[model samples]
Target: MTATSRSLSFALKSATVRSSSGHFLRELLANEHLPQDELQARQDHAARAIAEQAMQESPFYRRLYGERGIDPRILDDPRRWAELPILDRATVKAHSGEFATPEAVGRGVRTALTGGSTGEPLRTLHDARVPSLALAWRMYSWWGIQPYDDLARIGRWSFGRMDAVKNTIAWWPTRQLSLDAAVISEETMTEFHRAVTRVRPRLLEGYVGALLELADFLERRGLRIPGPTAVATTAAPLTAPVRARLEDAFEAPVHDEYRGSEFGWMAGECDRQDGLHIFSDVRRIEVVDADGRPAPPGEEGDLVITDLRNRVFPMLRYRNGDRGILRERSCPCGRSLPLMEPPQGRTIDVLHLPSGASLAHRLTALFSAHPESVRLFQIHQQADASLTIRVVPGPGERSRRHVEDAVEDLRTRIRHEVPVRIEYVESLPYTGGKTKYILSDLPAVVPQAPTPPPDTPSVRA
Candidate 1:
């Protein structure tokens, strides 16, 4: 096609997509208040459809399920997602090619690479609209923000020239002013602050670390941005102290958003902000125990999820390596979708002691409690199993005292003496443009094994 003709064709196609997406957005808004039974029915229908598609079209699921004696016809029977084996990132990485299917929702599927936040990078596949829909439902539908509202974002922009332009084009329509999270300095932040204040967007959104850093910088300089209706933080754990500072500094209500790079947006906060409402319509989510069976409701465990909409590369039971709890009740926002405790941290962050293991947030509880004294901290479990905490002092003068107190408090709670060391620093050094709140110097990652189904069939290549 000629260049001008191609441009004209693209513009026409874009208009059609926008019109249909507007209708889909309205349909999603309508689905928000659906009764529990109706929501379950929708989820069931989607799950059955996705599951059948995977078993039939995706080579990975067909072989895996067949070898485990899971007949494709079994999807016709009423079943929970837990009945199928738990799928982890490690397994997906090993058999990635087997996962792909020709099916898709939008134009077609494309490759997606994760940030390797858990120290292992992942490559997955997704269609275009699934991600757009995820973000829209999370922010626009759930958070009660409008799609066309002016938004200011602080996030990592790609270093590549071409990738950077792609990012710009993707976000261009949102009327968002974005600042690169990688380049945060007094000069850059000042420029960003000036720009944001000038725009006065309705909502401010960014990674947890970037937002906190901006809040700290603004607080230090005594410069405040007067008017953001709301703040949304994601990409890392948003502790209470972090949320408070963002709200205080921005002068707005702060909400936490939960998502995975491998999977699209899974859950996020609504206007009520009590808990994250899992996007159950597109995601079949469960909190699974270490053995991969569903954890009892209200108990925290690893999250095993399946994307019901992404037939392009169906993730049947993907353990994206994050851990949290599923609330027994629905959100107070009147959505029938199930609620979940917001992600505390990735499973890799969970500290393994000789006696027992502690969740990442619990281990950081003391430091999080002393936010005035400790600006940032990382809990590292050495190969020898000794624990070392590296802390960056806050603007407050009581860093040593608060660190001592945290050590003492942790000792009491764990009730066991483990070799523990403290290292103080001016800042948490960045690795790949982000800071790690928890690290493991251990040799390797332990694989999680799921319970096997009965009546197995033979394996095939």
Candidate 2:
């Protein structure tokens, strides 16, 4: 074999060694070849097992099932699984402790605190060497990344002992490098760019917004770092414009990953770049309509998920708070795993009306007509039921009329006099160095609000 071929062969072997028991890796390889009906049967069996265990072990779930009069066996029936109550982030946060079973805790599962884009901290527990990590490794493998290959990640640093230890160990075998996304300036970007140059990672992963900002800075400074084989973005939506820009700046293909802190690596883009393939062996994903019915293929709905492997804290039919469409057909890549549209954003960001109604993905529609005038926008809802429309206007008075027109259009679409006010600025302020599209300063928002939207919306030219 050629020297390059020999190096790849060695790396694959190292990856196999690093995947703990390699149980998940082996299962993932097998499941990919399984027919759709067989795959669904496996997921159904796993789901029923998780539900039964949750009712038996978890205090929170046991009490919830008892109160709702839901038999744990309902999950055993494919049709009845939809009848079980849905759990959201607030419910999980409130009863997080009860979600952890004595057996799981005694067996020493790892707990992770994920604040996400909402800035609300959520703590969850899983096995120390969770199957989700193996799923992630498999996804990376699709992008030609082995577990021991170099990966440069840009995100906030975790100071926990476990995080530190994992980082230290991952670096040795994989050369994992991390750059802080929380701090960004000319000096910091220059340093981060330099680090990427030295590491020369095979894969780059992190928040799309942060990378886009860094890419912009690098392009302006005429500093061209060699592109990695692939760039994967999580924690935020990988909008088309941002994806194109990142690909241009880094000279690499950008792929989107759909996952959350509650569950790691639910689905990911394949080499086809068509839609994300569900990690069906580990998690069962569903797109449900308002009445909690399964949405037809190619129709958008709320994303509900069930964790098949997280026995400690069963996340069955858990509302992911994101909206996406379920694709009707199989992927051209020939992977038996199902497909779904990349999430638009969180469900909380959907404008809620008191008339037993809510609107999804409508926030961007208000400014669509005023593309040239608006540079960026943020919608902030106040406690007193007033709306603050924050806008970063583009240069020149020619665009001012369009901005005003857009605000008027928003008021009309809202169909309510909620006291809309427009605030113009050079740029919208970011919390923890990240910009949010929709923010609520209302005191009763968190733990009460249903759908909180993500960071600031990008301007259309």
lDDT of 2 by residue, 113-155 (tens): 5544433335677655564566877888778776656778776
Candidate 2 wrong stretches, greater than 4 Å: 1-21, 116-119, 157-166, 346-461
Question: What lDDT tens digits, residue by residue, belong to model 1 across residues 1-461?
Answer: 23355345435534674655555556666776799889888888888888888988999999998899876556566465557888865588668778888675346776665534443334688866553553454455455565555678776432477876775576454445777664355766788888888877778887776676677678789999768888888777766656656776888888888766677677788778778888787788888887787788889888788888787888887877677898888766677878889875543234555643333333434454444465556777788887787876655567689778877777665555477888887777765334566788766433222232585442311
Score each candidate by Cα lDDT: 0.68, 0.70
Q: TM-score of every model?
A: 0.70, 0.71
Which candidate has the top score in lDDT? 2
Residue pairs clashing in model 1 are: none
Backbone clashes (count) for model 1: 0
Give me the overall lDDT of model 2: 0.70
Candidate 2 residue pairs that clash: 348-451, 348-452, 349-451, 436-455, 436-456, 437-455, 437-456
User: At residue 451, what lDDT does model 2 achieve?
Assistant: 26
